[model samples]
Target: MKKLFLGFCLLVGFTTIAQTVADPPFMQDTADKYFFEEAAENVDLLQIASDRNKAIKVLSSHGLLLPHEKIIRQDVQYRPLLDMKLVALTEYQGQFVYLTNKAVLSNAWAGKLYINHNIKTPKAMGIGPDFLTMIAGENDFAIFKNNQEVWRSSINNLNPISVQHDLNSGQFLILTATGLYQVDSDLKTVKKVFEATNLTAFGFYGDTIVLGTTNGIQILDRNTFTITKMDQKLPWTEITSVKNIRGSLWFGSTKGAFKLRDDGKYDYYASKRWLVDDQVVDLAEGPDGSVLVLTQKGMSKIDFSPMTLAQKADYFQEIQRLRHIRYGFTSDLAMKTPGDISTGYFHDTDNDGLWTSMYLAGELFRYAVTKSEDAKENAYEAFEAMERLTALPGLKGFPARSFERDGYEVGLHANGFSEEWREKYEKENGRIWQLSNDELWRWKSTTSSDESCGHFFVYALFAELAPDKAWRDRAIHQIKIEMDHIMDNDWHLVDWNGKPTAWGKWNPDYVNGFPINVGDRRLNSTLILSFLQTAYHFTKDKKYKKAAENLIKKHGYDENANRPASVIGFVEGEDLSNTWNHSDDEMYFLTIPSFVNYSFSEEQKEAHFNAVKSHWEVERSEKNPLWNYLFALSGGKNIDSEESAWWLREFPMDLIDWKIDNEHRKDLTKIAPNFRNQTYTEVLPGDERTLHLHNGAYRNNGGSDGNREYAPYIYLLPYWAGRYVDAISAPQPE
Candidate 1:
């Protein structure tokens, strides 16, 4: 039976990996589950009518019934009660009563009649704790006791929209278009407490009355009767309903629903993952603290429960399973369609090699820490993909951006072609075409320096930790060929036309021409030093060491390396530092581990360590787990393990690059946008930030989607690296 169940789960794309282990610390224990029921069509109202757990009663245009947790439909046995088309239900005098268009039904399930209150119009109704039922129409309201009218009052030009019996205060509050009225316990005298021209909804938060108006929400103090507008604190100005669930205040609007916490912070839930429709009409709380939201389309429930770290790990592992599948032999594909894992289409990014290398590094660390054979196999496979990159191209040791079959033509066109040459190529494919001599495969050309940085960084790791001797030898050979190619071309990556690629230039003419204050000089110097050190360590080649020594002696590369960390952010005149180059940041941080790990001497190690520390100090505000984890590996202090965990939690489960707009959010503190496009939020990678290929950590406005979607390596690299460096502990199995 167990085997059959496992087979059934696999057939439906369920992961069988044991995820729940001994409880992990810093676990996010809550998740929102959604339910869409066609039977409850146009679900406009929801309420917890019973004290029993999960007995969530919902009212829709079609019927009224108790909604089951697992089933999408309410039970069919309650169809008789639903056929009455009851507008509202309430507990009155120890019996469940429901109101229809013409009369109030008592013992609703058994079709017993209560009071035939032949009301022409029913605007709102509520039952007080004293067994007094108040039913209101357009301009008047009646109070009833045991099916007999006790008193009635004329609202006088005011439209009674809703009536609430405050259980805590033991008072009846009536909401109308003109003003809010509070009735005395004796049900005789009524006083107008607050006045609003366009009052739509009202709820009680403790003793304070929250009124929803056309502009925003107004909080009226019961004692002082002072009104405070909450327009500036809400995400939207138009309010639909204001509900107080326990102590927390939930505001529903045309945009979505948001909860104002006791701490004055806000949690917004509006995406398709959380809502059936963005327009929220009403909200109700279940007996077990589950929130049921009523929308125009359907109902959604958000259940808060504790989630262990093992569960989160399993989720990320499932992401890897569905998205990061092998394409060729060892080439792991980062899918372009992020949310749609079944698309089977991968992005042709310029930094495919670099991205894959980061994943390889992550898997290698995973293998070292867990001794998992799966991790080892994944690492070895990615190593083969990286190896193929160097040999697949026309130029020896020149790694291609990516390689594909002849028919699979996608991504950026080749650069540095004459107009006439481009015109001729346009006749065939409209882009620079580089087909293999055999016409079977084609590799993207015009590779940049970033690719080389990724190559040397991962190759160094393979040399140090690869279990197979053949793997280490292949890594070493690739390092020599690539480094030799760079040196032979005078420290520049020569292209098909024998000219240095736009971004691969690192000769004295380009590196020394920049001012001492410029970041390019410092960035290039650091990269070249790291590359040369990596090449020399693996091949034991003196020429690579000599090249490094010459750069330090003749080009002031050592002084450039020692440049203060202030060169990181923005410089007044230096264009390079004025704007944050996220690609450069990735290259610098990835290179640091291998550079410091395989330094030529103690002096070199100390110099690189200082550089790494200084760089990390400048980037400390980013709260990037990957940067913090890498810095910890370089022996830096205060690695921010807690903040690393926070970052992973902040990363949304939906990896798709959906356009998110938070500019109109009133809760956010706005700062003057700068060259780096920094946001007001201190947390790294704000929600509005773009999830780009290399610059996923940078600030971005929410409306535009990038061509490439990031791989799981963005999360896996830091997670495993944290474990490898003892910054985070792995969860023990049950």
Candidate 2:
């Protein structure tokens, strides 16, 4: 009877090991459509305008700076001048005109400088058809026609601020601090057209004239000559400049620039996301339907390039390949100068394993859909880097947070690490830096559940999908060791100290210790279940299946695993639990696939499907592609495809970490802060907000001063995943 029992145990609990990766049955509409992509480059700018050929030209302190190409860029081609201190510029009759302190000159039309040296203290200048010029000074203005002074007029001591050509009226308009004036094209009559206080700027919008004031904007009808005040909220009240580009009114204020959308809502372009500085000095129409904004320090071009989602994915993929690779791991760029890609360098991050796993998963998806050899090579390289993390520690199934060469560990005085902090860290986490087995490298410790979740999810996908048998076996071997270590060590990642790592604990005492309201309790339960399911799916081991069943039936883990995300917020008296943990969301969504994909029974799968849906419903407003695609894969219908595509299409082409602040914008409806940290009624579009991965997309305001360039994996992962699952389609020809 004892031999029979032992044989039963061996048959059911023991197993042979072997090995192994989107949401959705919906196909993305493959119609060729275009979306505007935004990026920024720094150039010294005093004024900007497109030349006759539609080439971008900037007036700087030195002279004119022309775009190296038709598009704006950092290394603008310089046109040096030693003749005058240029303060203003205009484009007219295929001639580039410039304004000095007391003279107006053009770029040697017919080999002769069209100079008006009589104009004194030039404050502003404007040019019309045939080089008809009006130069406004402190108290007077002069008009020149065909390089000849035609008329001079006194401004009534109001201090002229701007001179502009009214194309619709064929007249020149002069703006002073107090009012607007008009001059006939024949240079015969001058009339005071309007009177307003604190007039700052103006732009012609169709048949109406839009005027900018210190408080708000005023519009005047050209036919009726009646003025109406605009009451809509602006990004900032004090408009510095305004221009009409492509029939839309774009206003520049002290805070930033915003465009009036067709829906009446303003698309705010502020912070370093769209400009070098928020203090805008001028606005002009740029080449190829772009808008050039001149600020206190530099010029920024807001471009509108026609691109498809697939094209954008290729764009981000190129960025990922060109700059983000580090030791086979996808890495972000650290820059010495803000927004300068040339000054960028790659560095180690706390979530190297997690980030690389995400990128590797993306490449695998790309290969699955397109069968690109490049994508396969990318996946293979990332897999090796991750495998090295597990091998470096020499601890079965444990992965390092990151690694560096032997001499790269920061000293006590370096990188803000103090002796006191190091001592405390040693006590709690047992020395973050551990010499690898080879002694040629150092691996970071305190390997949290974040890394493990990424590891199991990606390794399993590799085992299942890798084309080569040896690579698939290697991936399966890694998964078996990791799952075995967790199960053998009481469902915890026992670090080198023989104690469970701080965030890797899944024991009932550790997970259920918290009240049902805490997210850790729910998340820990979900994580362990998914891990076991994945282990069993690949290894076909009864022990993994048994361990999972025991947790669910005996420990109430099933109840905890299905808890809605709404219930997992703000546990009072728990410091770390006082707010929603974004990192936890990343770990949860990343690992939830296994729970849904490898359910033990139909009933369990149904419950998991509902759990994924419930969570996705709560996050619906975020329009995050990663979460959306994950839910679609979990058997969810009615997933938001348009909004998900919008999220992907609007992601900024510039991956630089530029400081973006939205708390001060008046266009947003402020809401009382909640446990989820949602501080506004609506989430900002991707280009309008800070660059965030799936985790921080829900955050209202965040960014650093152009220091780090995030790896493009944040966009690549969802894009390629969507492509693989047929939720998104390949690029169609234009």
Number of the top TM-score candidate: 2
- What are the Cα lDDT values of the candidates? 0.67, 0.75
With a 3 Å backbone cut-off (N, CA, C), the pairs that clash in candidate 1 are 29-305, 29-306, 29-307
Per-residue lDDT, model 2, residue 543, is 91
The sequence of per-residue lDDT tens digits that candidate 2 reaches over residues 520-582 is 888889989998887887789899899999999999998999877778766679876887777
Native-to-model Cα distance after best TM-score fit, residue 1 in candidate 1, in Å:
43
Q: What is residue 150's positional error in candidate 1, in angstroms?
A: 4.6
| Candidate 2 least-lDDT 10 residues | 28-37
Give the residue spans of candidate 1 off by over 4 A: 1-99, 103-117, 130-132, 144-151, 184-186, 222-231, 271-273, 286-289, 295-300, 326-344, 414-433, 568-578, 684-694, 698-700, 703-710, 732-734
Candidate 1 structure quality by residue, lDDT tens digits, 191-235? 888777888788888778888876778888866668854565677
